[model samples]
Structures are given as C-alpha cells and as structure tokens.
Target: MRVLAFLDGTLGDPSQPYVRVDNTGVLRGDGIFETVLVVDGKPRELGPHLDRLAKSAAMLDLPEPDLELWEQAAQQVIDNWEGSSEIAVKLVATRGSEGDPDAEPFGYALGMEIDEKVKRARTEGIGVVTLDRGFGPDVAERAPWLLLGAKTLSYAVNLAALREAGRRGADDVIFTATDGSVLEGPTSTVLVAKGRTLYTPPPTVGILPGTTQRSVFRAAEAAGWTVKMEPVPGGELAMADGVFLASSVRKVTRVHTLDGVALADSTAVHAELCEAYEAQYA
Candidate 1:
C-alpha cells in the first residue's frame, strides 16, 4: 500500500497526484531527500537521516527544514502502513514552485514497498562493476560546487550510471575517482574487510557520510574488530579479504564478484557484521 504525508500536516493517498509540475524539483531538480528504513513500524537511525537532510538543505541554499513537521509526516505514514514488515520512507523537500520567490519549500514523506532485488541482495549478494566518476580524490576541496555530499533529487547522473551498469551485465557499480581511488556505489557506500579489520573511504573523498556505514562500523567495533575510515585504492577491491556495499534499507550486501572476478569468501565477516548490525537495531 502507498502512503503520503504533506508538510502542511495533511495525509494524502500516495497514488493520487499531489505535487505540482511547476515545482523546481520537477523543472530544475532543486530538492533533497532521504530514503530510510522502517522495520516493524519503527524507523531506525531516523535522527541521523533527519540531520543529514538538514545539512543537504543548507548545502543547496534552500530554506531550513522543519524537522518536527517532517518527523510527524513520517509518523503519519508509518501509522498508516498496512503491513508489519520492513518498508522504505522517503523524506523529500523541493524549492517550492517556479516563478514564486516567496513560496516556501514543498516537503513530504512517502512510504513505499522495498524492491524484491534489494531484498535479495541481503542473502544472495550482488555483482558490481567499477566505473570512473570523472573526478579526483580532492573533489571535495577542489570542487566544492559539486555538492556530492548532499542527497539531492538531481539524480539523473546516478540513474544513468545504473543503466550503464545494467548494460555491462552487473547488478551495481562501484565508482572510482580520477586518481584511481575507490569512491562509492551509486546508491550505497563501499566497505572492505581484511582479516578482522574494516575500512571505508572518508567523507573528504566527496562521498556522502553513510548512516548505515557508520552503524556498521560501530557494530564491527563492538564485535572486537578494528574499523578504519581512510582512502581505499581501486586495486584493493580485489585484494581485500571481503568487500561489501552498505545502505539503509538493504543494510549490508557482499560483493560476490567485481568485473566478473569472484571475490574472496566473506561469509565469516558477513555473518559477524550482520549479526552485530541486526542486534544493534533489535
């Protein structure tokens, strides 16, 4: 079932048309959003996701979000949910309508079912291909205009990359910077394991600070494993004892193959991390 809640404190049927076409989110793509996990009616890591949404708004020069309004909207949808399983909630805000400077930002929270493929990734893992993101490791410092940290609605490039990945006969893509350093996936963050240690690229590398990745780090540490936030070289993808992509709804998924080459067996590390992560939420 589809559910929606508006910023003006009104709940609407998500299947019906509500968002006007004149909004900048439709015309010029001036908006930000967060897709969060709702399991058994409770939103996990919701506070951090809200905080990140605010940061994204500030980066886009958009008006500050009314977090209370957004939170209530989310709760409204959760309350309306018809199932007791895991669901995805997208919190969104656009720069209002076009040709109206005085218009306040338009915002809402939408609830939808998770994709079957995403659910499958949790158990069967995924095959990924590496693609160049056409930027360097210094992108954050050299080109702050990119706003790579924000989860904006201008996702045409990300969507195109996924299409390219599909054409390449892979389920996903891992982007590498111009400097040949590993960056992140189109919709997830990269995590590598070596022995009992875990590593992920730092935020300074122009990647979004992943909320799920952070939780996974804490989970790993709690399990007596070392966690490091550092630059990951592209070559290390193959050499690492285990490689995984981390996301909110999908949680953690091992990279079964990279460019058609089988990855090192990560079952031990995968299970330990998953156990710790689920326990953290439980």
Candidate 2:
C-alpha cells in the first residue's frame, strides 16, 4: 500500500503513525470517506468523488475539504504505487482529537491493489441476500441526524450486515427498508434490468448516491438502455430480467441468485455494461 497524509496542508508519510489515539474519528467513527478507482496511475471520476466527499464532510460538520490538497495527496499515492494493474485510492477525513474541538480534521489518501475477491466476484458473479436496514425509505427525509446519505466512517452496521449475509452463505447483501423497498447493498448500489430498462432506487430512499452506478447509467444510456430512478420492492429482483451490484472497486457484478432463488441470466447485459464501463477508464 502507498499512502499520503494531509495534516494542515503538510504532506506526511503514510506508513508513519500520524493520527493521535484520541482522534474522534477512531473513537466515535466521526468521519467521511470515498474509495476511488485508479487505472494506469490516473484516478477515475476524481472530481465527482471529491464533490461527494465534501458533501459527506458537510453532513458531519467537519472542516471543509481542501480539494487541491486532496488531489495532491491522491496523486502522490497513485504515482508511487506499482506492480498492480489497478488500485483503490481511498480518501478519508475525520473529526480531529476529542479534547481539541477546534483542531483541523484529519485527512489521508491511501492507494492499494484491488482485492482479488472483488475481482473474482466481478468475473463470476455473486449471490446476495435481502436484509432489513431497520429504517423506512422516508427516514432520511424525516430524520436528518442519522446521516443516511453520508458515507461516514461509522460502518459497523454495514459490516455486520455483510457478515450476516456470509453466515447465510451469500456473497453480499441488498438492504431493504422496513416497508420492504429495495435500498442498496452495504458497499454497492443495486440495479435491476428488465429488457432494455435499468432500474435503481432513488437517493431519496436514503442510500448513498453511487458514483460508479452513475457512470454505469450514463454508459448504459448511451448503449440504448433506459434508466429509471424509483423505489424497487424486495420481490422485484426475482421478476426482473437481470440484477447487478455496482461499485467503484467491484465495478459491475452480476447477481446470480437472491435468497437462494435463481435470477434471470444476465450474461449478455453484464458483458455489454462491463465493456462500456472499462471503456470509460481507457
């Protein structure tokens, strides 16, 4: 792994310990993050990822992100990374130490090789289980403090959901609202296809707006696929022509089964979308 840290406009060595033990980001998970894909040493969709990071930071009342500084850090890490065809460049910002409320936010960028498991899942597809997120679709609108749309570091619940899916013998999880509306995966966005029309839950459903999914939708649209943003019921996956989970690191992965029930074959559609997605990076 290659890393660069930005501490008050100063770049620090990533391998060295910079974060204090009292940082609230570690203690309370009061932080935000974005994982970007870097191909051939260029970070893909960097502007959008930075924009989303700013939004997440704003939600947490953390210091405004200096995009220029982050860009420098990311570039440093990417330039130093070697021996990998692709890398995952992660940008993270945390609320500073607990005792010093006026301290600047801690921020860093890390570059590492993409996980083999994620690559394998993209190549061979995966099985998923539906899990309740314990919140309704309208919760984000009703309660803003839960930070439903922010990509904060408080991910224990999401990790727990994934573990539960593993225990059920599935590769991933699709979170549903208490009312049974499809939300998204723990680390990915959900998309279902019916013929040429592709459907994904709207951000109003309290799921993070997926940068990779947005890119895939743009590519899918150019390829003559109709894209729709609406509420998807948990039962709709079984009836759809195909289903997929999309994210930056995982790219586009086909869902072979949902809750042990086989979904419609998505081989052709998956191939087309994957081609379109990779074309953007090229």
Q: Candidates' lDDT values, in order?
A: 0.91, 0.89
Would you estimate the TM-scores of all the predictions? 0.98, 0.96
Give per-residue lDDT, candidate 1, residue 270: 90
Clashing pairs in 2: none
Best by TM-score: 1
Model 2 scores worst on lDDT over the 10 consecutive residues at 2-11
Residue 68, candidate 1: C-alpha displacement in angstroms: 1.3
Write one digit per residue (lDDT tens) for candidate 2, span 1-282: 565655344556666888899998899999999999988877888998999999998888887898988888888777677658788988989888888858778788877778898999998999999999999999998897999999999999999999999999999999999999899999999989988999999999899999999999999998889999999988889999889999989999999989998888898889998998788777
Candidate 2: which stretches are off by over 4 Å? 7-15
Spell out the clash pairs found in candidate 1. none
